[model samples]
Target: MSPALALEDLAVERGGRRLLHGLNLTLMPGQAAVLTGPNGAGKTSLLRTIAGLQRPAAGRVRCQPDAIAYAGHADGVKSALTVSENLRFWAAVFGGDQIAPALAAMDLSALGDRLAGRLSAGQRRRLGLARLAVTGRPVWVLDEPTVSLDSRSADLFRAMLAAHLAGGGAAIIATHLDLGIEALRLELSEFAAPRDAAPLSGFDAAFA
Candidate 1:
């Protein structure tokens, strides 16, 4: 089968300032890819483009509908809604009953009845990840997924990602930490570096 998603000659600009140029990406089933770069290197911009939240200035991003799930820095949880309600809302939105499993996986099963706004920073981040799980999409596009997460919560998130990749799912994660995921690294900043100083193209590294 063809790759789950592909970005060909992707270029993005904002206010006449180029963010990304000559970017090409391919994600296949069961593979995980990570993007790493200094701040403002367009990692989030690339994620947003891949998620269809923003259009690339010049390029084509192709993927199957309902095949991708994205979680950005902002988790769109409603303060008034209880955790269970939030999960239910996502379930209804995604047309799946994976809410319970998602909550349980994130260790938020007991907090289901608590209002989302009452949750701590770590809790909110986990809840955001849980919402993504409910989508049940084959491809996951995550931006800074472990931000504000405690060690335990980070472990849980890593386990979730490991399971997803093992189950023929694909992911494009943008984070500063290594995440210890066996993945291909797309260093966006390298593209902006002088040609002689750039890292080799298409680098692969093992989980560490």
Candidate 2:
């Protein structure tokens, strides 16, 4: 099968500074990849570039932006909406009717009626993760997905991830925690951009 996502000689930059360069990677359907890196290793920036949240400095990402369901640092939920409503809103946007399944998967069924603003940190994170389910995208690219999750909540996340993979979806997770799943480990720091590297120019400069 063709890769769900592919990066060919990809370069990522943040704030006019190159972070990673000449990076080659591919994520196939029904598989997962974990980005292993230090704080300044450019994991988040690469993910943002793949998610189309940021423009890459050079090279190419071989996937449509819409095909990626990105869960970033922000919860991206409306505080006014309840747990179920939050999922419903995302479902409406992404053309899915799986809010109920998402709620159950994230262990948010018990808080279906609770406003997002009322949830604790862990609850909010779980709710954020649930957005991935309702997105209806083929690829899941998450950043620090289990930030505030406790043991049980982490287990729930693992089950949901496994379910996604089993159903032919792909995941690229940037995390430090061992979610107890086997995935290709991409050590981002290995591709650190050279300090003396010049920024992209001409045509590419426009997007940089």
Per TM-score, the best of the predicted structures is 2
Model 1, span 1-208: residue lDDT tens = 8898888988754434456778888989988889988888888878888888866767788888779899999988898999999989988898887587898888999999999999999999899998877887989999999999988899899988888888889999988776767999888975552333322222111110
What TM-score fits each model?
A: 0.89, 0.94
TM match of model 2 to true structure: 0.94
Clash count list over all predictions: 0, 0
Total residue pair clashes for candidate 1: 0
Give the worst 10-residue stretch by lDDT in candidate 1: 199-208
For each candidate, what is the lDDT?
A: 0.83, 0.89
lDDT of 1: 0.83
Regions of model 2 farther than 4 Å from truth? 201-208
Local accuracy of candidate 2 as per-residue lDDT tens digits, 1-208:
8899999999998767788998998888888999998899999989999998777788888975589999999989889989899999899999877788899998889899999999999999999999998888999999999999998999999999999999999999998899788799999889998887787654445655
